[model samples]
Target: MLQEVAGIRIPDTQLAKDAADILREHGDNLLWNHSNRVFLFGAVNVRKTKQHYDLELLYVSALFHDLGLTKKFNSPDLRFEVDGANAARSFLQQYQIPDESIRLVWDAIALHTTPGVAEHKEPEVALLFSGVGLDVMGDGFEQFPADYREEIIKAFPRNNFKRDIIPAFYEGFKHKPETTFGNMKEDIVKHFRPNYKNKNFCDCILHSPWTE
Candidate 1:
């Protein structure tokens, strides 16, 4: 079934792809598919970014990042940073992926939840963003409940949070404190949203602000 679905000729040794097949619970939650597509596009840009590596490394990293999702869900105690990287390492060792490639895979897994780690860098940062960051926010990140959906305005590095996590959770929501929530409210209501009468700079969304 997986061979028919994936339409590729891979051996039994490559459990990552098989893992992907096992993990596709919903059509929309096909994180692995999204990840694969992101890697396909991201790698094109990675090739142009002047980072030294073979194609193999990118493939290994891209495939490895999502390994812990099901494992985490089945036994919810697993932290993404701990369980995800360990799962990736186990697979990489089985595939005989080199040490350097394994490191990239580990880094990719570690920081997929926290983009700020790769924020300023190219390829590495964008690869992680394209792979999971964008999906974690959905098209607008507005589908989440009001308490958990908020803007990302934190300054980089130390103060920055995992901007995409809260906005896309199906359940197990986390709410930011007042200062954080108020800042997000300002960003959405003041900066992103506008008064209905102010037509000059406002987007079409607020054109008839109260009438929607």
Candidate 2:
């Protein structure tokens, strides 16, 4: 009973279903819906450009990309992105998926939050990054058809996303502020935890062991 939205077929393989079920169990309604939308949006991009891609990998990557933000998957020391990426790597390993495919999923999840870089990687990585950007920030929003956008939203309502997603980001990694260094996520930490201090690149350079 796989459904198509905007002419993109949802992957129905066992691997896809298993990944979806795991995410559904661990993630809240907002996250679950958002993840599903990411997969569809990524697939739609590939279809729109008539580019060849591995749909199942895209689906799995999208499903697992934000998983590190969940309580069950959050780790104490690693970046949330790496946490999610490692989770995908371990899951794919169990199925004996090829190392190269696992690597793509890992990179896609790890770099999805990074601008200017993910877009230059393999198609799956780039598409996942764009898909997330489109859903969260409306990047490339105009390229999608109006009716298709309406349909996608209907299937996965984004109720109060603008107001709620910030809190979601804060709660996900507030406990691991150190991991936010070198990324925009530090802004989230700074906003909510006012007393929190972010690492400064210039400060590190000036205070290094070398004295001029």
Which candidate's lDDT is highest? 2
Worst 10 residues of 1 by lDDT: 149-158
Instruction: Report clash pairs, candidate 1.
Output: none
**What's the TM-score of each model vs. the native?**
0.47, 0.95
Candidate 2: residue pairs that collide? none
Q: Give the per-residue lDDT of model 1 (tens digit) for 46-160.
A: 4345665444445545555555544333224444343456776776687666786667667766566553565454455446545454443442234322222221111111121
Instruction: List, residue by residue over 1-212, the lDDT tens digit for candidate 2.
Output: 34777677888888888998989899888887788788888888876667778999999999999899998889988899999999999999999899999999999999999999999999999999989999999998999777878888888789988888888988889888999998878888888888898778999999999978
In candidate 2, stretches whose alpha carbon ends up further than 4 angstroms from where it belongs are none
Q: Tell me, what's the RMSD of every candidate?
A: 15.6, 1.4
Which parts of model 1 are misplaced by more than 4 Å?
Answer: 1-29, 47-50, 71-75, 120-126, 135-212
Cα displacement (Å) at residue 41, model 1: 3.3
- Judge candidate 2 against the unseen true structure and give its global Cα lDDT, from 0 to 1: 0.88
Clashes of each: 0, 0
Each model's lDDT comes to 0.43, 0.88
